[model samples]
Target: VLRNLAHNQRNHTSLIQAGAVEPLVAIMRNSWDAAPRINAAVAVACLVGHEEGNPRLQLDETLVDEILDVLDAACQGTMRHGSFWTVWKLCQGLASLTVNDKNKELITEKGGVNILNEVLHDSHYNNEAAHRYALSAIWNLAFNAASRLVILKTPGLVDSIRDIVHKSESIRTKEAAKGALWTLGLEQDVKSLSETMAQDAGWY
Candidate 1:
């Protein structure tokens, strides 16, 4: 079922838009077993950030938080890609639900900043598709929530982001970093990030 959904690009997205998302959200909410839930989470992620809206599911306020909880649990596990993908989707959904500042605070409050930092630094997850989605989600949040407070609050965040921006050859990673840096801007934090970027520019 997952293969069919994942492989057929058009049909896969169509189901999500057609109200299958609520069931996926339910799976995440009730399932204690991680793998099935992870699969469901991944499916949920595939729907997130798409340009479709489901008016029926609009009343479910718990949707975003439930998805985020699953993603958070997945992160604590060893399966990096699946969990990371879940987070990427949740971030997209959250972006859809709230404005930039609200989303930023929600991401930060949910410890998304730390999770993104870890994923960015984890060499193993870098090449995975799920990780790419995670990076994009982080990029969106960083750009939306770019401010001095997030930088100051999340220790090692600035440096980790700088390393990815300057050192990685992957254009996706670089672009994600750029979104983050663009958020950081020419503020005093730039001095520190710039130094790290220069030092690590050739490492990756």
Candidate 2:
């Protein structure tokens, strides 16, 4: 019910005013069934996705942690399309809340960067859309110096991103990967590769 109501901005405002964050976080954290978890994640996303609502939602640190936990579990579990999309939405919601350095630090402290990196490396998923979302999450999280250092220091992260830029056929994936590398001061490497590929194709 709250999930449905969250689709409308006015209802979303009301739900937030009525203290919906705790119950939604509970459903996201405790629900055994995927359907409920997905719905709960979507509700949370709708609530935090708006600028007007982000301030209140950001005050609850546990809500962010629960969302990241659910997303990590879903990525490691069945990899069902619905589950993957729900997790993607959850990532999007986190990115939306990351309007400041403090929020980015909070997300990194909650293992958000590691979880997102894991999703990018999960070959079993093989879903381009999910990969794009994970890349976007990482990109958004790298908005601060501390978070950017975290991502750059992660083992094989730069290589993984390079592989995506060099190999991914999807333009969206390549663009997101490029954005991440650029954030980490690797734009020169990406440009060099682009030049190499262009020369190889005789486009130079």
Candidate 3:
């Protein structure tokens, strides 16, 4: 109910005022069913997506971990697409939270980099939407130097971003990858890098 209503920006304020955050977090944490969890994630994303709701969402210290746990469970479960969408929305929400250093540190402490990198590496799923969302989330986290360093430490993350920037037809994905690499100080010359990657992939 709150999930559906939160789509409107005006209603986001109402929902937050109605104290939807705590119950939504609980849904993410306790819902054994995938559908409700996914919906709850979407609702949370929509709510926190509004500037006003960010502080309120951040008030729940356990929210980040709960969202990550939901993401993890979704990835491991049978509802692949649902989980992917859930991750996408969750990433959007988390991206907004990066303005706070504590939130950034909490995300990293809760293994966010590895989880997002794993999503990026899951080629078997052939999920470009998920990849783009994961990239956006990573890009958001990369805004912090410490988080950027943590991401760069992840094995093959830079390579993965490079591949996405060079090979992905989606400009959004390419741009997000570029932003992430730029933050990590990995995007030296995009033209040269793309050319090199294309040559290696025989696209040139």
Q: Highest lDDT among the candidates is held by which one? A: 2
TM-score of 1: 0.57
- Name the TM-score of candidate 3: 0.69
- Candidate 3: clashing pairs of residues: none
Instruction: Sort all candidates by lDDT, best to worst.
Output: 2, 3, 1
Worst 10 residues of 1 by lDDT: 52-61
Candidate whose TM-score is highest: 2
- Residue 117 error, candidate 3, Å: 0.5
Per-prediction TM-score to the true structure, in the order listed: 0.57, 0.70, 0.69
lDDT (tens digit, per residue) of candidate 3 on 17-93: 88997898687667776567656756776677445335434423455666676666556543443444345555555
* Cα lDDT, model 1, residue 170: 73
Candidate 1, superposed: residue stretches over 4 Å from native:
1-11, 14-19, 25-42, 52-104, 125-131, 143-148, 186-204
Residues 1-204 of candidate 1: C-alpha lDDT, one tens digit per residue: 552374345776578567777887677557766555545655554555343353322312244444456556455553443534444444334433332345455656666566666655554432444445555655555555342466546777767766665566677667656665666663444456556767766543
- The local distance difference test score of model 3 is 0.70
Candidate 2, 130-163: lDDT as tens digits: 6776787677777688889999988877788888
Candidate 1 Cα deviation (angstroms), residue 28: 4.9
